[model samples]
Target: MKTFTKLAFLGIFAATGIIIAGATAAQDAPAKLGDLEVTGAFTKAMLPGQPVGGGYFTIKNNGKSDDMLVSVSSPVAGTVEMHEMAMQGEVMKMRKLDTGIAIPAGKTVELTPGGLHLMFLKVKEPFKQGGKVPVTLSFEKAGKVDITLPVEAAGPGGHEHK
Candidate 1:
């Protein structure tokens, strides 16, 4: 009878610990802002002597009206700009989109390599892999959203290590 009581006590203690841990993890999960959802945000690890870095993410708009991503800013970079890459004839060109990228109503927009992305110019320090960088994104309708960009390997198609 004593052994049975002790076993029951241990089971209750283990169940309580799991419940607490699950609750804490749920609190850390990402949250949506009304009709906007931002996910899979990350930046590439900086290369040696490279002053520029790229940030990529996915933005989903669930509202009835369209939204535009106007600007992006980061303390680690001197300046951040929204840019688009395209091929014109035989030449490859990249240009800044001052007007911002549009996120259509009920559609998702992706900022990835070789396409629409955020350019971090004049970085204060090289971004290291397995690190997190904070950035603020300004949307025409969504207002300003703060997110952490996880740093991954030094490649055009790199996944967040964290």
Candidate 2:
């Protein structure tokens, strides 16, 4: 009776270990860009024939040195440029910046609307809401990281986190 009980307990423990391992594997199944951490990601609604779309996200520098975000690429758009918005004279101007935005060491840089954002111009098709867009964000030091941008409804915010 003692031998049978020990064998049953070991079997149960082994099964639990396998279950936990499976869960962890599923969480990391997506394609990764680099070691940079991405948070608070969101994007505006997409409309047919719209000239551009904007994406906002927060990046955190976990390393000791600072890094620059050089560019972005997306399959849904023909061109993805790092852009900044400002008021030039009486007009609100959006300018494409060839150089990427810099993030300080141990600091979080937010790319929000009306600020530094990724401009998705000349979209190939309408980005359907509640869909997924694969975006590759390239950085100077972190190299490139691929992330899935989840499309949301026409709203004021996307996915936000503290």
All candidates' lDDT scores? 0.69, 0.63
Error of 1 at 25 (Å): 18
Segments of candidate 1 deviating more than 4 angstroms: 1-31, 156-162
lDDT of 1 by residue, 1-162 (tens): 012243453353243221101110111235366688888777667767776777877789999999998888999999999987654554445688989999999998878665677888899998887877788888898798888887765542323222
lDDT of 2 by residue, 1-162 (tens): 012243443453243221101110111243433546886565655655556666767787877788899889998999998877554444445567888899888798877655577878788876666666678888898788877666655443323322
In model 2, where is the ten-residue run with the lowest total lDDT?
18-27
Clashes of 2: 4
**Candidate 1 residue pairs that clash:** none
- By lDDT, who's the top model here? 1
Regions of candidate 2 where Cα sits further than 4 Å from its true position: 1-35, 87-91, 157-162
